[model samples]
Target: MSNRDYSLSDVVALLVESGDNASTFYRYSDDVPMPSVEVLSEIVEDLRTVLFPGYYGPSEITPDTMPYYIGSTLDRVERHLADQINRGYCFVCDKNKVDRCQDCETRSRNMARAFITKLPEIRELLLSDVEAAYDGDPAAKTHGETIFCYPSIRTMTNHRIAHELYKLGVDIIPRIIGEMAHSDTGIDIHPGATIGRSFFMDHGTGTVIGETCVIGDNVRVYQGVTLGAKSFPKGDDERLIKGLPRHPLVEDDVIIYAGATILGRVTIGKGAVIGGNVWITRDVPAGAQIVQSRAMQQSFSDGGGI
Candidate 1:
């Protein structure tokens, strides 16, 4: 098969040409490989191994070999990340600036180094997450079980690491890292979401935590739960506003259960328990417990919205 252009504008054009109707096959427009996504995943996995030496990749790593291994991994990671960052810079930036793009490569390396320096902090945060999962679920046998097996913990770990890079302004790669976890774990957490400590997820498949969502400490979310946006308000240029908080504010100790979809900028109050398959657009008071009523049958939109 021949290659086709599938840029976002190209896709929009195709849809318009087809009278706003397109098949599932039509939805896929480009076969061009995205190497950056895989490279970002490999870099993150390398860091994960370095962070949890005995648990993630190689258990036999010793102090003697640790420096060599770390140095080697960092070397490989920097090269790959620099290439991706430069490519992304080339994509969204001015064409004239591309020829003189000297600083991006350096900036990418520096960001990678900064992320590496923060591994200890990542591990510390993950410890609490592991503990939270262990305690939150009766089925979780141990902290080891949570670390080794839980999909939510795995997804959250990647998000936490990627979130740091996202905050540090390394464009495009954080989403890649999060997508890597999404592919492996069936959990899609946006890299830009601000998650706090001791977050626990239970049976976390089909959970979509959107960008701009601010989750407070000790929040527990279950399968098919979505902390997402309402309607997107467009600006004067018809472009959706960038960097505004669009998703839900999930407060501390809230337990959002399976298939619950909370949208808009509504606050899910502290200690509230949201039940399965419920659609919530309005704010719930603290200590509120919301359940779905069978009397109200609405079409289930996979992407959560009211």
Candidate 2:
């Protein structure tokens, strides 16, 4: 029945109507190009190679050949990162209805160069993370095994890179980078989260660290743990507010076990230990140990009476 009635002209008309309906979600700016996820994926890998040169890159890396490899890798990173960062800048400008695209090229190049310069710092922090993972897990044989085989290593590496871009005020790309790691590792860490040194995630799958979370040094968390906001505040227009500090602030040396969910902007003081499967919404003092209390049981009569 459809074959007898529909023609190519009718199909073209329907396609036009569909496109019209999709206009609200489409970006129409010709000057602004969306950041490429594929390109960003490659950028993350390249940066990883730089951070752990011999481990991630070619196996032939030696002390004598390190300089040439590093120099060439850095050059490639600069070129690709500048292009992607420029796209990110333009995309944000278009979304915010700002007319700063003219200067974005210069800004992107400068930001990329600045980011490259921070590689040493990033590498230092990542080493701390790797150390934390190795020390926290007794099963880990060596730092190299943890670096190559652990999901936390992959997730944190991506997070550290994305966090740097976020700090530099780059938009969209950070979130994209975060999502890439999330997809690959099953660990979700927001780019805006302020994580400190020696952060460790053991069995990191299903861990969620929300945006605005401030984690201090030597903090460790386990699988299925969530440091998240309890609720969202709505404005007069009923729109959810943005940019508020909503996630928890975890202090140094805190250990949150598996399935522990800490909500809102509560603080977990230094040296505190949160036990598995506990739900916390309030601040816990220093050196405190939080665990779920035992459930009370009631005796019942035989059959149906209580």
Leading candidate by TM-score: 2
- Regions of candidate 1 where Cα sits further than 4 Å from its true position: 1-35, 62-68, 94-100, 293-306
Clash count per candidate: 1, 0
In model 2, residue pairs whose N, Cα or C atoms come closer than 3 Å (at least 3 residues apart or on different chains), thus clashing, are none
lDDT of 2 by residue, 1-306 (tens): 386798989988877888886745478886567899999999899888889987897978999998988899899999999999999888777777787766777888899999999899999999999999999999999999989999999999999999999999887899999999999999999999999999999998999999999999999999999999999999999999999999999999999999999899898889989889988787777887776654310111121111
> What is the per-residue lDDT of model 1 for residues 86-120, given as tens digits with 9 covering 90 to 100?
55555444423334455766876777677777877
lDDT for each of the candidates? Answer: 0.79, 0.89
Give each model a TM-score. 0.79, 0.91
The candidate that achieves the highest lDDT relative to the unseen native structure: 2
What's the lDDT for candidate 1? Answer: 0.79
